[model samples]
Target: MDKAARKAILRELREQERARWWATLGLTSAQLDALHEHILANLIDCCSGELELSEQWANQVGVDWSRLEQALMELGGYCDCEVEANVCPD
Candidate 1:
């Protein structure tokens, strides 16, 4: 994907994650900021093939790459492999 396309996808992904966090726990703006940072770092790693995923972080937001990838793919994006998960264990 081009830079613009990649940026847009990341933006969408971040917004989706933000919405989930907001609805689930009503996180503060600062918390949202941190969450965005975490998401971006993980996203970069995944994209670059490093694949350094943090299950703790994933659990915090209630979704993983696999789940996010599914959501993105359903929205017409391409996913090359499995990601973490979207749901956390109860």
Candidate 2:
């Protein structure tokens, strides 16, 4: 597919995901960024390797962990590998 097509596809997917998130709970962009950082640093691999994910390479930013987890679960819990039933998703 062409670049424009790929961008459209990605944008559509994000819209769908955002809608799904809104349906579950109201969220703010900062909340999303917090959870994203947490997941990258903890759950995802950050090593320099062929399989390493670029998202995890950024510097850690301060975040309120509990609040961020709550927001992420509400917004993108299904996308998470597995969340502890008792604990909120990241």
Candidate 3:
């Protein structure tokens, strides 16, 4: 395949993988983006060493806290800062 074709194929595969990853956590790309932004903004103060900020954002956005927390924990996001560091889009 040509270089452009290869790049496009890789991009498509990445999109598919991202979709599957977010789907497993019951979150859409937009939701993840919002969550990332929210956590990032809050982390400016300090990481409460917990998911307090994440849970607040999830509650505001009407996402299931339990499910999201479970997924985050599985991905090594045991805290708000960890979530920003670990659970983010590429």
Candidate 4:
């Protein structure tokens, strides 16, 4: 394949992977972005050593906390700072 075709294929694969990641967290891309921003801002002080900020963001945005938290933990995001660092779009 030409370079353009190869690039297109790679782009499509990335989109698919991003979609799956968000789906696993029961969130859309926008929701995840919002959550990330929230955590980033709140984490200026420090990580609460738990998912406190993430849960607050979920409640504020009407996201399913149980599903989101489970998915985050599975992805190695056990706290606000961890969520910002580990759980994010590609």
TM-score versus the correct structure, for each prediction: 0.29, 0.32, 0.75, 0.81
Candidate 1: list runs displaced more than 4 Å.
26-90
Clashing pairs in 3: none
- On TM-score, the stronger of 1 and 2 is 2
> Given candidate 3, what's the lDDT at residue 23?
77
The local distance difference test score of each candidate is 0.48, 0.46, 0.85, 0.85
lDDT of 3 by residue, 1-90 (tens): 899999999999999988876977789888999998998876755687889999999899999999999998887788888888844332
Clashes of each: 3, 0, 0, 0
Give a tens-digit lDDT track for model 1, residues 1-90. Answer: 799999999999999977865554344556545544664555643443322333335467675546544443453333221322322211
Over 4 Å off, model 3? 86-90
Rate residue 4 of model 3 by lDDT: 100
Flag the better candidate by TM-score, 3 or 4: 4
Error of 4 at 58 (Å): 1.1
* Residue 19 in candidate 3, Cα distance off native in Å: 0.3
Overall local distance difference test of candidate 1: 0.48
Candidate number with the higher TM-score (1 or 4): 4
